[model samples]
Structure formats: C-alpha cells, structure tokens
Target: MLEEDLLYVLALQRVKGIGDINAKKLISHCGSAKNVLKEKRQTLEKINGIGAFTIKHLFDSNNLIEAEKELEYIQKNNITTFYFEAENYPEKLKHCIDAPILIFKEGNFDLSNRPIISIVGTRKITSYGRYFCEKLISDIKQYNPIIVSGFAYGVDICAHKAALKNKLTTIGVLAHGFEEMYPKSHKKYVSEINKNGGFFTDFWHNDSLIRENFLKRNRIVAGISEATIIIESAEKGGSLVTADIANSYSRDVFAVPGRSSDNLSKGCNDLIKRNKAAILTSANDLIEMLNWDIETKKEHIIQKQLFVELDETEQLVYDFLVDEGKELLDIISLNCELPIYKTTTILFNLEMKGVVKPLPGKLFEAI
Candidate 1:
C-alpha cells in the first residue's frame, strides 16, 4: 500500500471499538480507509452492524496523528506492511473473516505457491514431542514446505529449528510488536529466523505484550497455513486455541496421538475423540491428507505409453482413471462398478507397474 493510504489504515486500526472485521466492513462501504475516516457518523451508522458506538470515535483527529507516527516508524525501519486486500498478503489468511486488516512482515521468505503448515504445542515439550516434531519436518522436507509457528517455547521453537536445519523457510509469528521481544532469551534466535524465513505480527511498534496478546496472535498462526499440527499439548493450552481457530477457518487440523495416561497428550487425544482433528501419526498422514504428495508429483513430468499391459478389469479401471485424471478410491470403485477390495487390488497392481499412485485422502491418479 502507498504511504498516504497506510497512514489511514494505521489510523483505522487505532480506532477504539473498531477491529479487523469492522474495519473491513467500513473500508468495503467507503471504498478506502481515507474515505472511512472522512465519512459522516450518521452515514456510517446507516450500515448494518455499524452501531452509533462504533462510529463514536470515527472522527477522532488523534487517530490520524498517531497513525502518522506509526507510519514514520514503519518507513524508517523499512518494515513491510500487508494490506488485507493487497495481492502480497498471505492467500489462505485472506479468506478468514476475522483476519487482521494489516500485518507487518519482517522476512525475505517467498510465500507464493508454497504449502505452509503451522506446528504448535505445549511450551513444556517432552522428549517424545520433540522427537515427533523434528521427524515430522524431516519427513516432509522433500516437499520444501514452509513451516510456521508462534516462536515461543516447546513445539513452536522446535518446529522452527527443524525447518532451519532442513534448509526450509520458517516463520515466527510474534505475540508482541517489533519493538518488544517476549521471553527475551529468544532474541538470539531472531537473526537466524530472519535469515531463514522471518517474523510476522499485526501489533504496532508500541503495542504492549500481555496474556491476551498471545491469544489474539493465535489466529494468524492458525489462518496463515493450509494445516495446523499440534505435536503435543496439555489438557488446556494456547496450542489448543490455535487448533480450534484453524478448524473454525475450515482448514485441516491434525493432532498427534499419545497414550491415554500421558498428560501432555490429553488435549490432542481429546481433539481426536471429539472429531475436531484427524489423527496424525507421521508426515505421510499429513502429506496424504492435504494432497501434498499429489502436488509434488505434479511438479514432475511423466511419460505415457499406449501399449501398457492390462487385463480386463485393470484396463477398465485404468481407462476410467486416465479419463478422470484423478479420483478418490471410493469414487473410482463406484464408477468402475467394482468391489472396493477388487479395485484396491487392481490399483496396487497398477502402482507396482508405475501406472497409478495412491495419494492421501484416498485419492489416486493414472501416471
């Protein structure tokens, strides 16, 4: 966004009682942030859900003055701001209704067309959780996915470190603004994180670091990715909140299962029991569930042959798969008028001959 426009956006963010959803609503109605500030209270109140109280502070001149100060800090620091509607904003996050209207980014990472996943869990990570978290990233390293986390203790930092060790970009979403770093010990890791991926936040330079800020920051960690993985969590924690937000966004939520007696595993187990999250056993489970394996295959070229050997049922299934390009296992079986077991047997044979490959979510395609 331009400097003049950013000034208005920052002002809108500073307006008391006005938040991302309302700011977006006002912006949509007025055409721009500048117009929203200039619009009359009576006119704004005419819009549905725009109560008198919402616009009570709409005409505050101090908003613009404060915004100007923030803008100056932004310009001097070279911080990149992402307008909610801008092309450069994270695509998945854009679809979220409650997503931040503006996000300050501080990284050189390429987010375009990359599969992003959020890894979160309890701050008191155990050896079991650490092993699982690291292994998960390592297994998926071939896909070169971008790993996202809160950059706090436990699973968050573990996931980031695993991503860096694997030479993959990892983003650390902060609960506070750029001016303050929570858990001061993490200051040393910021340099490496920026070099690998970087930090993101909606908080301003002078925003305070508090308990509620962490809860609010969970949304970004949840909404910015295709999936959110909870490696380990106690019965109640912030990671569970992030997982809930991810589910609310209609994104995939995966929880690593643990023994019923394990304290840290209770939250993940409960999530699975309540059907809020799918069971995540390994990287393959996630790879298949999100169709990452299919995406990886699409990046490669595969040659086709007209004279590949196939028996009667195999030919029928092969022809159906070839015509459809890709299909779910059940869909393929139903369409081919074959029993699921028989279809599975044929698909296995085809896979052995490099004719078809199985994907996560029980999807398959002719190669």
Candidate 2:
C-alpha cells in the first residue's frame, strides 16, 4: 500500500460514527480511502448503509491531522500496518465483515502453513485450567501451530508462556495501542514476544485501555484464526463472546469439558451442552476435527496423478501446491485467495482424486 493511501485509511478510521462495515462499503463504492473521503456528501449519502450522520463526520479536519501523527509514529517505530484489501492481510480475517480496515502489527513471526488457534478464558484461572492449557499447547508443539491469546492474566498468559516454553510462535492480541501496555507487569514479556512472535491491535497510538475495548478485541482473536479454544470461563465472560464470534464466522470452536459444578467449567460445559462448541478433552480431538494431523510419510514428495479433471478452485489450489512445494492449509487459502474452509474442502477433494495428499501439521503436497 502507498503511504498516501494508508494515510487516508487512517483518517477514515478516525471518522466518528463510521464503523468497519460502513467504512468497507464506502471504500468499495469509492475505489479507495482517499476517494471515499473526497467523495461529495450527496454521493456518499446515496451509498447503502452510509447514513447522513456518517457523511457529516467524513470531512473532519482533525481526522487527517491525527492520521498524519499516527502514520509518523508508525514509520518511526517500524510498526507494520495491514490493510484489509492487501494481499498480505490475513486471509481468514479478510472474510470477516467487521474486521478492521487497518490493523497495526508489531511482530516477526511467520504465519506460513501454521494453523492459528486462539486460546481464551477467565483471568482467574484454576490449577486445572492452567495445567490443561499448558499441556495442550505443548502437545501440539510438534505441529508448530501459532497460538493466539488476549495476553492477560491467568489462562491467556499461561497459553503464551506455554507456547514460548515449547519454542512455538505465539501472538498477543492487545486491546490497546503499542504506546501503553495493559496489565503493566506483562510488559516484561513484551520484548520476548516481539522477538518470537508479536502483538496485533487496531487501536491507534495512545488509545486508552477501557473496559469496552476487550469485547471489540475478542472479535479479532476469534476472527484472525481458523478456530478458538476456550479452556475455562464463568457462565458469562468475554471468552464465551469470542467463541460466539468464532462460530458466527463459521470457524471451529472447542471447549475443554469439565465437571458441571465448577465455576470456571460452567462456560465450557455450557458451550458443550448447548452444542456451541465441541468437547475438547484432548489435543487429538482438535487435531481430528480440524484434519490437522495425518499420517507422516518418510518423504514429502508423492507421485501425483496426471490427467485428473479438476474444477477451477481445485485446480487453483492444486497448482499452488505443485508450484509452492508443500504448503500449509491456511497458507494455500491465503495465496489462492480462497476462504479457509473452502480451501480445506478443495484439498480433501484433491486428496480423494489421488492428485494430492495430506501430511502431518495440515500440510498438503501434490501427489
């Protein structure tokens, strides 16, 4: 993305009353953020869902001023900005209608071929939750999945530490900006996380850490990945909300089953009983449901069948694997510009056709 275009996007983000859905609608109709901002009020009003009130705020001079300052901070600090329409933007997140038009990134971990899973739960985790969360990430270490969490106390921190201990990449999704770290004590771990993985936030620099932001942040936690795992929660908590968001996105949701009487277990158990989430007793359940683990072969290459008829989407994914030489399921979806679930189905069909095969860690290679 060009610097000028990004500036306009940042400015558009600052426009009060215009949320992501409307921002996207405006951008889609106008061509670019710059065009959206420059469009006449009458023209913008004619666009669907963009009401007169939103257009009233579109010409606010302070929006650009703040955007320029934020852009300067971004440039000086090496912060990465992800535009929703960019090829480099997260593929799964792109499918979410409410996903931020611009998100700030501060990390160095690669997402290639790695299944991103968000683990969220209560801040006051019990011994059982801690034990299960740590062990779960450790058990999946060999698969080299990217663990995502809210970076809070209890279950969130436990997930991050477990990922670090296993030498696996972990991402801390923040509810605030990089300028201020919440739960100040966790600041010590920031350097290490940045070195290994990194943090993601849609909030601008100097944004306040308020209560409502966490709910908004939960959507990112749920939207950015292929699935969400809730270790523990009270009957009603933010983690459950994340699970709901994940479900709304048609992403897999897993909850650790526990005794009904336990407070922390109630959320997970409720989710399971309500059929909102799968009962995740072990890592194997997740592995099987996601088709993330298949038999490991001695070699990566296989004899791919020739002259097999394939649809346009199947051919797209198959050609990508043949050309890319064994890519992850999510990576294939990203580069092929297909939804993750659709990519999974296409890969399954390709496997059935004897032209592709699944390997451990959700990898696929041309037969």
What lDDT does the true structure give each of the candidates? 0.89, 0.88
TM-scores across all candidates? 0.82, 0.81
Misplaced by over 4 Å in model 1 are 295-367
lDDT per residue (tens digit) for residues 1-367 in model 2: 8899999999999999898999999999999999998988999998877779877889989999999999999999999999999987888899999999999999898776789999999999999999999999988888889999999999999999999999989999999999999899999999899989999999998998999999889999999998899999999999999999988887888999888789999999998888788789999877765656544221322334345788999888888886775777888999999999999999999999877866433567775
Off by over 4 Å in 2: 296-367
Against the true structure, candidate 2 reaches a TM-score of 0.81
As for candidate 2, its clashing pairs are 302-367, 303-367, 304-367
In model 1, how large is the Cα lDDT of residue 309?
Answer: 77
